[model samples]
Structure formats: structure tokens, C-alpha cells
Target: MTELLANHVCGRWQAGTGPGSVLRDPVRGSALVRVDATGLDLPAAFDYARETGGAALRALSYAQRAKLLADAAGVLQAGRDAYYAISTANSGTVKSDTAVDVDGAIYTLGQYARWGAALGDARHLADGEAVALARDGVFQSRHIQVPARGVALFINAFNFPAWGLWEKAAPALLSGVPVIVKPATATAWLTQRMVRDVVEAGIVPPGALSVICGSAAGLMDQLQPWDMVSFTGSAETAAAIRGHAAVARHAVRSNIEADSINSALLLPGHGPDSEAVRLLAREVAREMTVKSGQKCTAIRRVFVPGALYDAVAQAIGAQLAEVAVGDPRSEGVRMGSLVSREQYDSVQKGLAGLMAHTDVLHDGRRRALVDADPAVAACARPVLLGTRSPDAASLVHDMEVFGPVATLMPYRDLAHGLALARRGQGSLVASLYGEDPAALAAAAADLAASHGRVHVVTPEVGRTHTGHGNVMPQSQHGGPGRAGGGSELGGLRALDFYHRKAAVQASPAVLQALVPA
Candidate 1:
């Protein structure tokens, strides 16, 4: 019998006693692990985090908490090799892709650790200078940020198990709140392992962190007014969580980052021969194959000038053609399989929906495997579809094929490209490629309304610029409308989500006492 993954509740690890959910390897379709959370006390887990964990964390100052985070990062960094091995079998990601999640998590923790310096020894953060509330200066009003007295429940997505857990946990811990992570069941093994590692390191207090390896039954019902629920997944799930009676009635603070049809645009003046055009093609192909396009920030829409549409399509197709998809552990395999058969089917369904309004340009459905059997593996080819009339192809803009699939559309000019990008309702990111800085600037200004972040690719920055899908710790990572209307990872701003700000109005002496020294 396969060993069931354990759930970390309170301060100890316990194996789930209920029937298990089989987690399969994406490359070989073999059962890797069994996950179950039956017989687990959901409310008791939260209570442990809030009372035991929260007390321990809250007893420390902001700087002390920050140092703990730094120490935890060191421990995880040392275990990178072990993490990569797990990711290869569980998530079907190439070594480089795994580095992005594993290393990215460590880097985010380090960044938060350094950011805590600005927070100083203050237990609570003062917002700004005091303002006179009355005619006399003796009476004034001030705002201060203090950590919530409740636990933070993080419901993460499957694409980034490690990064998702740490990114949210780092800030919550630093802000003096304990974290209870509910990783997506499909990829919970990696998350469970990481939590175990953190626990064994003894860097954090016992109940400071916990993991629910199976269903999140009765989890939301345990949320109090001061508690927070941070979620990342589909828009449909986000909406349902937001509407939950516990959240709506008690007004629990909830943050969400949902699926987005992110786009990369090629400016009109940048013809086929331009470096900007080549760069755009390269970026589009990279985003498509990276992690098999499971990323929510991946470019699902490609908008090119009407005159250069064919050129862009040919360039991207050629680039994608060279990509070898198969077992992630095999040599020379650039891309891997979808996370599971269910995800494979979801991608096919999304592809069929886009094909309803467009024609296939590069069919990724049939491809030569590197070292794995396609029949058993949950693999899909990187499909590139094209539509001449983007405005008429509502499905092309609205639907997101969450695999190695993207649509090539033609726009009349910059305005048309911006309009077409907005047709996704909203997105986490959008990229514009061109040599003309003025043109790129203008396009970015217009697209800013609909996108959380804009990537401007020029001849100079193209060489040094990070790829379009990469999210930095210094920048915000959420969008409006269809994209969840929440902000995350914007330097010190991220701490705001974990902490509550309140206005303190009183006499100068009383206000001074309220403010952190």
C-alpha cells in the first residue's frame, strides 16, 4: 500500500484515515502519492494556529519575526535539490521550471526579510504624521497598522505550490499572524513536504504553520471577522468563496488572484524584420511552453499588426516546433505533460472552444515524444491558433486555454491592439513590443487600465528584461475585473493585506502612547 501523505495540524503530523485521493505523475501516469484529510479536525486546526501559533508569533516584534523568516529561507534553500526531484515527478516541470517555483519562493522570503528592516522594532506601523482633529493641536488623529489577531487561511493554486505557500506565508508571519495553507489537492505533496521541512527546521513556533492535505471541509466556516482568506485559482471558485456565508456575513478579509487571458502585443511599425518583432515571437513561444502554460500569467493572446500577422505566426510556430515535449526527467525535453488527465482534458476543451472561432496555425496535438509514452502520459502539444477578425472572435478573447496554446490575432493599429487586449475583461499582465519608446509608452498608458502590470519590450531592454510571465516581488501581481481585484507582492504594500489599519484619534499624549516607539 502507498503511504498516505500526512497533514500537519497544530504541532504534530498525522496521516489521514479516510479513503485517499490518488495523485498521479503527469509524465508516466503512475500513482505518486495518496492524499486524504478525513478524520481531521478542521476547526481545531484553525484554533491551534490562532491561539497557539498566533500567540507565539505575536509575542515577537516585527524585526524578530523578520529574522525568523530569513532563517527559514536558508533552510529551504539548502533543500532545493530535493524539491526539484519532487517537482519533476509530481508537477511534470522541467528542472528550470521547478527552479522558478522553488527558488522564487526562497527569494520572496529573503525579500520580505530585508523589507522588514523598514518596519523596525515597532510592533505596530504608524501610517503618517499626526493631523490636528480639533482646533487645538493637543487633539490629533493618526492611523496605525497592526497585525490581525486571527489566523490567515491561504488556499493556493496548483501551478505554484511552493511559491504560493511561502509568498503568502512570509508576509503573514512577519505581520504577526499564523498561516494555515490549503494547497490544491492535485499538487499537495510538494507543499506538504515543504511544510514538514519548515517544521523540522524548528525555525518557527509549533502552531505557526499548518497544512491541510485533503479537502478543506468546514475550513471557511471557522473564519472569524479578523481572520483572512487568501485564494488563488479560477474566477468561478473565487466568486463562490467570496459569496460564502461565513465570508459575507462575518466580513472576513479575502484576497484572490484568478485565471487571466494575458496577452503580448507587437506594434504596427515593428515589421517582420525588426528585433522587436523577433523578441515578441520568442516571448510568446516561451510563455506557451514554460510549465506547459499552466501559469495564470502566461500569454494566452498574441496581438500583432495586420500586415505582420503571418510573419509573427510563422516565427512563433517555428520556435515552438523545436520544443520537445515528454517526460520531464528525460534529457533534451524542453516541455513536460499537463499536471494530470483532468487538466489535459480541460486544455483540450478550451482549445476546441477557441477553434470554434479561429484556425489552427501550429498544431501541438501531435508531436514527437522525447522519452515517454504519449498514450499513458497526460501530454498535449503546444497548439497555436490564428484569427484574422479578432473583434468577431469573442471566444478567442474570452476563453483561456490553460495549456501550451495561444491565439494569434491581427489588429489595425495600437488602439485596436489595446482594445483587443481589454476584451479579456482584465488581465494580470500585457506586453507591448517596439523600438519606439514613445509608441510603447503610449500603448502602455492606455493598457494600464485593464492590466495589473505592463511589460514594454524594446531593442535595449529586450536583452536584459525579464520574460513577460515572470512576477517580481517588487511589483504588484493582480488585475481588475475578470482578474481578481486584489493586489499582492508590491514591496511593503503586501504587508498591508496581512495587517489591519485603524484610525487612532485622541490627545497628543494618548496618541503618542498608541504609536509604536
Candidate 2:
């Protein structure tokens, strides 16, 4: 097996102190890589980032830091082919699907770079002249932007390892803070490869970046007042990290993006024969199968009008039937296995719980594999469970399978459908299908309280739609409550985490003296 070593401190790579961990190819069920992360010195890694790396990064202006991010993006883009090749081993994704995550990062970095360049050298800006109280003709207060004198610790999830890392990377780096990433063990190899490519590019400072492949032992122990921590994973995990005593005592910034039970609403305007209905059907199936439906924003609950339940179910069922499951590297194969047998088993357990709560409308093939080795069990099907009273709130809210599984609940009417969609307390995203402007507006306003992102799926956009489950770099990716009340990506909003906004109380003439011209 190919060995994946732990990359720590700045520009340093090492072998683990304990026996290595083997990562298997989900499709072939053969070992693909062995990762070593034992004896990984978390304290040293954290110190290197804070003391050495943070100084190098913070010394540069935001514009210079953004340029570094842009240059790194170019280097990473040149190596995109290699990233895709490595990702296939994990399975359940197409080249296009991978691009959405990988390319999205590049796009985000590029955008942040431009934003920083626009900041110029202005530290304090005069909103307007305020009347003075201390002295006659004297003014006070100006908005000033200052970089935090600390490091950003990124704890990423396994599903979208690249995107998760970049979502925080662009914002924090552009805001003039160094980043230390701790990728999920399951997919840390891919992240390590990316990190290696960046380091070799020589665009970033020596200590501006670091990676840890194993447990974050003393990393949290070394956090300081201005340090920032961002995590993308389960709610429980995010909560634990937020509650870290060291982090709390130091008043470090903590951002959490957790997995949530998101939903999609189907409005009443679209007829069975309408193009919009067909498009929504395809979108639903795609979300169920894409990434083996391992995405945090995947449509966990799908709501349809009671009169159109059968039509929606039939359309999605037919679309899912054509999905070929086998090795992703093979031609004509649309879907692949989960990250591992352990993940497959976990999906099954979640599906069992979902099955108990609702009736199955379109249950995907689970008994046997279709195209791959018969001995090997593939990931479960694109499930469509049916619920009678979706508006009841207790039936379908907050239920998520985190796999190629979703529920289709029939609503009494348009108003009822919106209410059903809001049943999920808070979500990363929710998709709506229909052409009725009034209905769409009402639904969006009602569900806005629960969902962090909303997608209006229509025929015009659906024909060229990228699907409902995708997350972009410019938009906020996290949700409220169940989705971890943390925000990621929102342009400058993300950068605020790595920066501290300070109000400077001084005369315009004094500010002018502080910043010439």
C-alpha cells in the first residue's frame, strides 16, 4: 500500500510513532493507502503556527496575503487532475461532482484575493462627521480593521475535505492570519497531498501553513485570546470543541458547521407534465446519489403536494433506476460505494431508523450489487420514504440519514408545504420547486427562519441546474441550531473571524496623520 505520512509544523513531514492506519478503496475493497499519525506533536505544531507562522503571515498586508492565496490557487489548479485521481479511491462521486468542491475552493480564493486588494491601505474610514462632546470642533470615532494576533485552527469534515479547508482558508488567509488544518482521518491523505503541493510552490511564507494528520492532542491547550477555531462536522463534535476550557477561557473565536436535516419544498404550480416537475425530480435523484449522498447539505427531506406525490415519486424512481453503481473509474458508472464498509454500515443503521418512521416510496437496490463484484456489498439505494402528515412537525423534522437516502412527504397545500419544510428546526439548505412567484415568496419567507440557504428550482434554471445539494464559496454554508449556528463563506463575513474590528476614537486630522493620504 502507498504510505501517507503525517505532515506537521511548517514544511516538515514525518512518520507516525504508532502502527499505520490503512485506508481501503471503497470500490475494489483493496488497501489504497496507509497513513501514520501517531506521536504527532500537536503542541509543537500549534506553537509553530502561532509563534513562527502567525508572525510571518501577520507581517504582510491583507493585499499581500490575498496575493499568496491567489498564487496558491494557481498551483493547486495545475494539480487538480491529481486530486481527482486520488479522490476516486474513496468512491461515490463523478469528476463534475469533485470539481464542484475543488473548483469552488479555487473560485473562493480568487474572490477573496480581489477583496483584499480592494481594501487598500485605509485603516480608519470616516462614515460622516459626528458632533464632538469633549471639545468644540473636535470629532471622534472611525471604523478600523485590524488583523488578530493569533492563528486559525481548521478542523474539517471528511466529505468535502477540499472545500471545507478552503472555505476557511480563503477568509482567514485573506484577513492576514496563518492557518493550521486538521483534516478528518478518513480523507487526510488527499489534504496532505494538497498541502505538499502548496508548500512546494513557495508562494506562501515558510510557517504560514501546517497540517496535522492525527489526534489534536495539545493543540487546543495552546490557544490564546485572539486565536480562532472553525470546525465542520457533527453537531456533537462541534459542541465539544466549543466547550473546550482553554478555548473558552482565552475567548477564542469558534465557528461550527454541522450536519443537519435539510429539506426541499415542492410548490403547487407545476403540473406532472410540466418541465419544472421533471427537473425537480432529476434534482432530487441527483442529490440522493451524489457523493453517495454524504453531503451535509444533501436534501434529507423532500416535500411535495399531496396531489402530486405519485408523480414526483415515479419520476425520481425512474431516474434513480438508471444510476449505475460500481467502480467510479469505470466508464458509464454514475455512482460508487461509500467511503468504507464502516460508513456503509452506518448508513444502513440510519436508514433503518428512517424506515421505521416513514413508508418507502422508492426504495433503491440494497439486496445485491448490480455491476460490481457480487461478493462485495455496494452502498444503499436512493431511498424515498413517504410521510402522511408532514405539517405535523414531529413526523419528519430533524431526521437525517446522511447517505443516499431521503424522505418524500405529501403536503395538504402550498401553505402546508412551507410549514412542512420548516419542520426541520434548522438546516444548511432547502430547495423549492415551482413557478408561482407568490407561493415561492411565501415559502421562502416562512422557511427562512429554519434554513441557512435556499434554492428555487424552476424549469428555466433546472434545465441547466447544477442540482439542489451543491454548496458554493460565495454563499454561507452553515445553518442555525441543528446545522451548527456557524457561518462559512459569505465573502468578507468569513474574514471577520480572523480579524478584530476596533473603533478608533481620534480626530480626522489625527487619523490622516496616522495614515498619510
Candidate 3:
């Protein structure tokens, strides 16, 4: 009986042209909605964004654009209940987890608004008195950042639909560029709802916010030189787009946020008796359970000192086992279903491959329900792998089993742990669990080249730990090498990408005349 939503192309809701695909509840194998792009007018959508939406956004000043984004956030905040009811069918997430995707979006909007205010009126390049080139006193110079001449295209991932869309959307709108959002097929319904609310609120220009629910066919073919493209998903997909022939020919700027084998290191001093050790285990388990470990930033590896490997593994295993798994709607279920049976199988296959390289320390293998059908939802327990291989990089570093699966490796010292952590080529984040400031600093600096972000965890940060699976609005959430070399949501850095920069120089008299006095 649940009604599914469609894409918001141009100024209104639309249906696709091809045979539609059906979206199923992850907790229950029931049809949530049917989605398709068979009839979508891609050319018309692009034109509308360029001519209508892009015009209006560009017409407004930076502050004006931010006000529109803030208003859009207000609308989303008011309709969060609808989002929760719809999101419940996707996976098992606590209220806080949903907040990270839903409410966090509003916060991101606010952050972008603040960024606009900080940019000041003239976009000041350098502050100083003007130098006199001649006795007539005519020459001068100054720098400014301006908006690009086209729209921004955002292709989002499935896990945190609301957060992903808003994170990219907030910056684009704030930068005075309209946006075209293509939500991942798995969770397009949630994005549809939010976009619909945004449109109805009339916070932005009619053509400024375009949406496509299905295939992105013909979408890239019509891009202009001034436009920018951004994508978030697996490394394989990101690489494909970055290497797309059109992208290269058009010299289009592409930003990709890809999945990485993120890791966490537990220092040697943290024993089973240490509260820090228990806290680390708890944090690791929480990361696995939240969003059913569907996050691109999820901790796929755990590094522990050799002396505490057994204790760390056992503690983490027991905690992961105790996690309640079932329908996200059910009262006690702490972990939810995989995005789909396809993803569930992928997780299993990845785990099976990992088991070949490492020992299975804990197997939370069991069927979790999908809806009320009991056996329909595709679900699996978090798989824990412990490796004794002398070369951790060759065995564990190359193989990344995405899902709730994580491989725990042993190291002799802080230096050894740092070396092991870097074995994964590169990661989006690396978290260290220890109270030792010296050790944390040394290891973090050594591994800094491999990770984009690193968090040092202690009891003081326990309450607001954001977990290893979560990415904040202010952090750079992408990795290098295998993880994909693109970043998303690093405060103002996210906004500036939409606009192209060029330094203009001329004689003082000429520049003064160009500048509107």
C-alpha cells in the first residue's frame, strides 16, 4: 500500500520512458514502489535547468542563494516524519542514524549559508592601498571568485540518500549554480520526497532543482563546458565515469566520492581490562550495525597490537554477535537489511573471498526478515576476519570485503601498526583508539599520506564519535588510489567546485573602468 515516488525533472514530477524497475523493502521482500526512466525527456530536463533554473540561481547573489537553501532545509525539517516512515523500509537505523542522513542535511545547508556570509561583498583577493603606476594615479588590481555559467550535476549513492543529495546540493545552490540530482536507484524514493517538498516550498527557482530517478542515459551527452559533474559510489563506477570519453573530450571537471577500505588501529597499551579497549570494540560494532554497514566510510579493517589481538578480536566478536538483527521496523532489531539481495550476495561473496585469506573470528551469519514475509528480505550477519599472515598488505590490503565485514590484523608496535594500516593503498579515514598522544601523533603522521581523514578516539569523544561509518559535513570524505581521488563536503571547499576560477589582469585604468564603480 506504500506509494512510491518519481523523478522531478524540469519543474514537476515525471515518469520514465523504459520499462520501470521496482523498489523493494530491504526488511521485507515487498514492493515499495516501481521506478523507471522510460519516458524522461533528458534533453528537455537539461535545457530547463540551464535556461530556467540556472538563470534564476545565477541572478541571485550568494547570500540570496543561501537563503533559498536555508528555506529548503526548513521545509525538509518540517516533513521529516514522512521521510522516517519511508526510510524505515530501507534498513535498520536508529533515530540518530536517520538524523545523520536527514537532519544532518539541514545542518549542512546552514553551514553553506554561513560560508556565503564569510565570502564578503567584493570577494576580496588582497587588502592593501592601491599603488600609483603614473602621476595620474590610475592603475590597481584585486581578485574575486565568481559563479560559473552552467548547472552542476550530482549523481548520488544509495546508503545515505538524503545526506548525499543535500551535501552536494547545498554547496551548488549556495554557489549560485542550479543542480540536477540523480539518486541511486535503491533509495530514490526518499530523495523524491525531499525534492518534492523543496519544490513545493518554492524556496528556489523553478528550473534550479531538477531530478532524475532512473537511468542517466543521454544525460552526460548534453553537458556544456561551463557545467560540472560529481558522482558518489563504488570505486569501479567512479573510475568509469572519470574515464568516460565525453568527460575527457569536454574537459569537464568530475568529482567522485568512492568506497574505500577504511581502517581503525587499537594501540598496544589498551588491554581487555582497559575501558579504552571496551570502548573501541563498542565503536567498531556500532559502525557495523548502523545503516547495516552500507556506508562508503565504513571501517572495513581493524588493526590491533600483537599482544592484544586475541582480546580485541574476542571483545569485538562478542559485541557484534549480540547486535539484534531483524526488520528495522521491529522493536528490538538493531541492524537492518542490505540494500538489496544483489548487495547482500555481493557482501557474502566478498566475505567468502576474505575468509580464504584470513581466519573467521566471528560469523554473524543468519537470515534477517524482509518486511513481514520473514524470508524475503536479503540479510546477513557481520563477518569478522583475523589474519596471521606476516605480510598484511599482500593478503588483507588488496582484498576489501564491503559490508559489515571487517578484517582484524595484529602488529608488534605503533610503527608496525602504521605500516599495516597503509597496506590498504589508501582509505577515506583511519581511526586510532588510544589515550597515548605521542603514539597517536606518530602513527597518524606516518599514515597521513594513505588516508584523507584520521580520527583519534578516546573516552572524551565517545558520545559524539560519529562512528567510523559516518561522514560529517565539514570533513573531506574520499580517499586516494583504490578509494577514488575525489572529495565531498569539506565546508566551503565543496561550494567552490561548482565555479571555475580565472585571474583577470589589465592596466589600472582599464581595470578600473571594467569594475563597476
Candidate 4:
């Protein structure tokens, strides 16, 4: 029997009771651990965080809380190697992928910490200068932001255990609110270990940060009005969470980042010979293989000019063919397996659904593996499908396979391409590749309305441009419609999600007392 991972609740580690769900290694198909929360007290966990953890964090000034966050980042950064090892076994991610999650989490925490300096020592943040409410200016009105008096519940996705936990926890903790993290059961071990490190380091107060592994059953029932819930998963699950009795009745605040069928477009002037076409082809392939295309921000749709359709498709297909799929630890393996057998089946089903309307341009499904057995590991080769009649292919725009797969479509004109891109309803990101600066700018400006972020890929910036799938702390990371209508991680704006804003009307003397000197 493998080790049964423990849950961190109320400042202690407790072993779970009864038979638990088994977690397997994606690359080797071996049982890695068992996760359960049978005996844990969900209500008590919530109360402890609110009463104990929330109190502790609230007592500290903004600067003090920020310093603690910086300290926690240092501890996690020192343990990066151990996290990479765990990610390879559980998430089946290559070295680069692990860095993106682990290193990115650490960097985000540090950025938040440094950003705290601008917040000052004030416990309450003033929204703006005072406004005169009376003729004599004796009575003034001012708006202020304060940390919520309740705890934050973070329901994370399995695709990014480390990054997901840190990103949500950092903002909540910085804003003086306690956090209760419920990592996706399939990959909870890495998150569990991270919480353990932070706890042992003693950088955060007891109950400030907690983790619940296994099932999320009864967790939402414990939420209060002041409590906030941040979730990242499928749009279907997000809808279910929104409809939960506790959420709907008590009006518990919730933020969601759900399914996104992100798209990448190549402008008309960029043909096969243009550097812009090459850059776009490379970016699409990179998004497909990285994290096995499990990212919500990954490009699922590629739009190209009708004249350059075959040229772009063949270029991307050739790039996809060179990608090696096998065990993440194997030498020269660039792409790894899906997170589990269930995910493998899901991707195959999605591919079959896509094949219904689109023709296969590149089929790597039958390709030979490097060091692992395709039958034993949860591996699926990258597949690319194409459709000339994108308007007729409803499934291509609506479905998100969530694996190493993408669909290519040709548009008659820029207007047609924009229409096809908007068919995703809304997306986390969209990329426009072209040499003509004016054309790229115009397309990006138009796409901005439907996307949270837009990338303009040109030869000059191609060398330094962060790829489409990468999410930085300084940019908003949410979208509208199918992508979930919530925004987060736009620098200090992320703090707004954790804090409540209100208007304060009082005498000028009282106003001065309310704001820090």
C-alpha cells in the first residue's frame, strides 16, 4: 500500500479515515497515494480559520502581512527541486512545465510581496481623496477598502496544483483573510507538500493556510456570507457550484475561471514565406504540447487566411510530428502523458467528437513512443484537425478537448476570422501574428473585447514575446461567457477580490482618524 496523504486542517495534520481514492502516476500507471477526508470536521475547519486564522492575519498591519508572504515565497523557492520531482511523477509534466507552475508561483508571491510596499502600513485602504458632503466641508465622504471578515475557500484544478494554490492563497493572505485550499483530488500530493513546507517554516499564522485533500463534500455548506469562494475547473462544475444552496441563498462571493476555447489567428498578409506565419505556427505547436494542452489559456482554435491554410497546417503538422511523447523523465521526451487514465479517455472521446466535423491533418496517435509503453501509460499523441467550413463546424468552436489537440480553420477575410474567433463566445487569450504593425494592432484591438488578453506576434517582438499560454501575475487572467465572467491577477487589482469596498461618510475629523497618517 502506498502512503496515505494527510490533510492539513486547523493547524494540524490529520490522517483520513476509511478507504480513499487512489492516485496514480500518469507516466508509469503506478498507484502513488491514497487521498481521503472522511474523518475531518469541515465545519470546525471553517470556524477555526475564521476565528483563529482570520483574527491573526487581521491583527497584522498590511506591511507585516506582506513581509510574511515574502518569507513564505523564499521557503517554497528553496524547495523547488522536490516539487519538480513530485510534479514529474504525479502530473506527468516535463521539466519546463514544472518550472512554469512552481517557479511561476514563487515569482507571483514575491511580486505580491513587493507590491505590498505601495500599500503602506495602513490597515484600511482609502479609495480616493475625501469629497465634501456639506457646504462648509465639515462633513466629508470617502471610500475605503478593508479585508473581508470571513475566510476564503479555494477550489483548484488538477492541471496546476502548485500554481493554483499559491495564486489564490497569496491574494487572500495578503488581504488579511484566511485561506482553505481544496486541491483537485487527482493531484493533491504536491499541494499538500507545499502547505506542509509553509507550515513548518512558521512564516504564516496557524489556520491562515489549510488544505483539504480527497472529496470536497460538505465543504461549501460551511461557507458564510462573508466567505469567498474561488474556483478553477470546467464551466459545468462552475455552474453547479454557483447553484449550490449555500452559495445561492447566503450569497457567498464566488470567482470562477472555467473552460476557455482560446484561439490564435494569422493575418492575411502573412503567407507561408513570411516570418509571422512561422512564428504563429511555432506558437500554436508550443501551446499544444506544453502541459499536454491542459491549460485553460491554451490555443484550441487556429485561424489562418484561406490562401495560406495548407501552408500553415503543413508547417504546424511537421512541428507536431517532431514532438516526442513518452515518460516525462525519459531522455529527449518533449511531451508526456495525460494526468490519468480518465483524462486519457476524455481526450480520446473529445478527439473522436472533433473528428466528426473536421478532417485529420496530422495524426500522431499511432506514433511510436520513446521510453514508455503507450498502452501502459496514460499517453495520447498530439492530433491536429482542419476544417475549411468553420462556420458549419459548431463543435469545433464549442468543444474544448483539454489535451494535446487543436483545430485549424481558414477564414475568407479578417472580418470572417474575427467572427470565427468570437464563436468561442469568449476566451482567456487570443494571438494575432503578422508583420504589418497596423494590421496586427487593429486585429488585437478588436479581439480585446472578447478576450482577457491579446498577443500581437511580430518578428521584432517574437524573440521576446511571452507565448500565448503563459499567464503572468501582472495581467488579468479571466474572460467572459464560456470562459467564466470573473477577472483576477492583474497586479494589485487581484486584491479587490479579497477585500470589500464601501463608502464612509463622516465629519472631517472622523475621516482623518479612520485613515492612517
Best by lDDT: 4
lDDT of 2 by residue, 35-151 (tens): 666777666767677778878887777777778888988988998988888777654456766776678777777888888787665432233343344566576665555777888
List all candidate RMSDs to the true structure.
1.2, 2.4, 3.0, 1.1
Model 3 per-residue lDDT tens digits across residues 1-517: 4453667877887866556777877766778886677777787888888888877877777777767877887898899998887777664355656777888787888788777766544322232333555566554454445777787888888888788888888888887778899888887888888888889887888888878887777777767778888888877877778777657788778887776778888877766778788887888887776777878777878888788888889999889878767677777666777778888788888877778778888888754443434456666677778886637436567766557888888887777778878877878898888887897787778777988888888878877776666677778777787777777778877766777665445577565654445
Q: Among all windows of ten consecutive residues in candidate 3, which has the lowest summed lDDT?
A: 121-130
Write down the RMSD of candidate 1 (Cα, Å).
1.2
Residue 219 in model 4: lDDT: 91
Task: For residues 258-327, write the lDDT of model 1, one tens digit per residue.
Answer: 9799999988876687898889989999999988999999999999989998998899999998998888
The better candidate by lDDT, 3 or 4, is 4
Clashing pairs in 4: none
Winner on lDDT between 1 and 4 is 4
Residue 400 shift from truth in candidate 1, angstroms: 1.1
- The alpha-carbon lDDT assigned to residue 180 of candidate 2 equals 90
Off by over 4 Å in 2: 121-137, 366-371, 374-378, 391-395, 464-466, 513-517
Which consecutive 10 residues in model 2 have the weakest lDDT in total?
122-131
Per-residue CA lDDT of model 4 for 1-517, tens digit only, reads 9899888888899988968989999878889889999999898999999999999999998889999889999999999999999999999998998888899899999998988856878887888899999899999999999999999999999999999998888888999999999999998989999999999999999999999999998999999999999999998899999999778999999999999999999989765878988898899999999998889899999999899989999999999989999998989999888898899999999999999999999998878887887778888889999999999999999999999999999999999999999999989999998888888888888988889999888899989997899999999889988898878899988999889999999998899999856
